[model samples]
Each structure stands twice: as structure tokens, then as C-alpha cells.
Target: MKNNIGNQSDYDERQIAARGQAFQLAYFALLGALLLYACSEGLFGRWCDAGAAAGLCACPSVTVFAVTCIWRDAYRRPNERPAGMIALMGFLAVVNLALGIVRICEGDVVQEGILTFFICNTAVGVMAAVILAAYLLRLLVLRKEREEE
Candidate 1:
């Protein structure tokens, strides 16, 4: 196949297996979180709107998946350089965080004591920031290990 980036485009068996495990773990985490959210919402009226609640319930699972994949060394293909992906993630974090801050400043994050859908922007921004931090930390640790070896 013709390649624009690199010859290696697909993940190896180890990465695939790790990713499958990560997916399973993430799925279960999401289900568990949603269950807890449902129970809480049922018990104590609506604290947040549906969209904010969804974002709250979903961020942890996404974080779990990203962290698992990154720590397992399965986040990037063998020949992939993560620079572009990292830049994109950084951009997403900045934009979402800025927008979230703007909304909060404008007093749009909460309405009548209930969180609005605007909370999703901050949730997503935090998730992206967390994932990016994990990726960079792992990269640093790997580099240190290489230097030691």
C-alpha cells in the first residue's frame, strides 16, 4: 500500500490485545459510572441537566481509556510520531478551556442552581488536558528509561 506518513500503519498483535483490554475496562467503567449517576439522580432530583450529567458520566470513562492505552504503549502505531496528535489535543484543550471559562464568566454554566450543558466544555477540556499530561509524562518516563539503557 502507498504510504504518506510511514510504512507501518496498523497496530501489532500486542497493541491490539492491549487496546481490546482497555476497551473492555473503559466500557465497564462507563457503565458503572452511569449506573451511579442514575441512582443519584433518582434519589435526589436533578442536580444537573441531562447534557451536563452525560458529560460528567462520560469523562471518566474517556480518561480511563486514554490513560490505559497510553500507559500500555498502545496509543500510537509503531511508526507514528505523536507530535501532530499532541498538538491537536493541545489545541482542543485550549479552545475548550477558553470557551468554558468564557461561559463561566458570562454566568452561563449554571441556571437556577442547576448546571447547564455549558459544563460539557469544561469537562472535555479537563479530560483532554489530563490525557495530554499523561501522554507527556509517559513519554518522559520512556525517554528516561531509554537514556538509562
Candidate 2:
């Protein structure tokens, strides 16, 4: 009887964790694909190969690990906040924006198969930045209200 009563809360926590994992995987897939596209032999220059490889393989792997760790930390330690996850998202947005600009400056972004996908990356970056900005604004407003109170 006691176990059954507590099962609902446990079930809900499992659901939230499951959703977070799914979101993490989806984010990885999207960023991985874009990095692969950018690294395509004929699309970008030789200088970009190392950077692209780092982004495609190393970066995503590290990011996923970091996020999973943060999530687990929160799960295991209730008082711990999700500030790391928020920082990760903002960092990713900045990385995307930087990659987009690097591609554009390379002079090959508008050429051949790179044009459409490069634009897509830029657009995604812009969207991410907008979301980050919204989060920042909300945080600032809430802080101000707390101070006023």
C-alpha cells in the first residue's frame, strides 16, 4: 500500500527524465548533421576540417555527457539547480553563431551545396539566440521583482 501510494510521484519523475534524454538526443542529432554537412570535403576549406571534426565528434559527445551529468546531478541532488543546462544551451547558441560566421567568411558558403545548409545553420543560430535572450530577460525581470519585494 505504501509503495503504490508513492509510485505516482516516481512515475512522473521518470517521465520528466525520459523527456530530457529524448531532447538531448534530438539536439545531438541535429547538431551532428549540421557539423557533418559543414565538414563535407568540397564545401568548406582545409582550415575548417579540424574545427569541423572537433565540433562534429568531440564537442557533441562532451556536451551530451555534460548535460546528462547535470540532469543526473539534479535527479540525485534535489537542491541542485539546472543552471548548467541553461548555460549549455546558451553556449551552444553562441557556437552555432560563430560557426555560421566562419563559414560565411570562408567565401565558399554561397557555393555549390553549401548555400542552403549554411543559411539553415545561420537561421537556427538566430532562433537559439532569441530563445537565450528571452531566458535572460525573464531571469532579469524576476530578479528585479525579488529585489523590489
Candidate 3:
């Protein structure tokens, strides 16, 4: 009976560890995808009409990348993520939230020209906000559950 109980405990620990690892992997994957999207838009371009629009579109992607990378690093190696990273993520999250609100507020401008452009960008920002929030929530829940064990 003692051996069986010990084996079961060992199995449970392994399962928890695996879960933690899987969460980190998923966080990194999300960060990578967001970074790819940011790069495709040429982030450092001159601020012209198209460039400004592209920059706006890229904001959420950058935010997603920043947050997810911080989260992944923090999860994989607890207490290893630098304070700067946490600060950066917090800053980016606030900026993105403001930008998303601005986009929604200005949505009426879509009727003027290139309706698809406005629609697509707005949709992207909204989706990014939703996804980022969901990811953060999942991370918090997982972390809490891990701690309780």
C-alpha cells in the first residue's frame, strides 16, 4: 500500500510538471506568431499615411508578443524574468488597450475610404485584446492551481 501511494504521488507530480511545461510552450508559440505579424509590417517605417495605418495595425501584435514572452519566461523559470520585462508588458498592455478603444471610437471613419482596411484593422485589434486577456487569465489560473498543490 505504501509503494502504491508513493507511485501515485510521483505520477501526480509529473503530471503537474508536464502541465507547466505545456503552458510555457503555448505561451512562446503565441509570442512567436505575434512577433512574425509585427515584422511583416515593417515596424520602423516612416510615418506616412500608409505607414501610420500599418503601425496602428501592428500595435496589438507587438503587445501580444511582449506580454506572452514575459509570461512564458516567467512561467518556465520562475523569478527569472527581469523587472524590465514585467514593466514593458504592463506598459504595452495599457497602450494597446487605449489604442483599441481609439480604434473603436473612430470606427465611423470607415465609411470614407477603403472600408475593408478600417474593418480589418479594427477586427484585428479587438481580437488581439480578447486573445491577450484570455491568455493572461489562463496563465493566472494555471499558476494558482499549481500553487494549491
> On residues 27-136, what C-alpha lDDT tens digit does candidate 3 reach at each position?
66656655654575477542224534555445555545434543443323333333453454456556655665676587732443333234444445454555456556
Residue range 1-149, candidate 1, lDDT tens digits = 55554346888788889999999999999999899988988899888998898898899999999999999999999979989879978998999999999999999999998999999999999999999999999999999999999
For model 3, the stretches where C-alpha displacement exceeds 4 angstroms are 1-79, 82-90, 103-113, 116-128
- After superposition, candidate 1 runs with Cα above 4 Å error: 1-7
Tens-place lDDT digits, model 2, residues 51-99 = 4344444444444443443334322233334376468668868887888
Strongest candidate by TM-score: 1
Q: State which candidate, 1 or 3, has the greater lDDT.
A: 1
lDDT of 3: 0.50
Cα deviation at 53, candidate 1, in Å, is 1.7
- Global lDDT of each candidate: 0.92, 0.54, 0.50
Arrange candidates, best TM-score first. 1, 2, 3
Q: Report the CA-based lDDT of candidate 1 relative to the real structure.
A: 0.92
Worst window of 10 by summed lDDT in candidate 2: 70-79
For model 2, what is the C-alpha lDDT against the true structure? 0.54
Models sorted by lDDT, best on top: 1, 2, 3
Poorest stretch of ten by lDDT in candidate 1 = 1-10
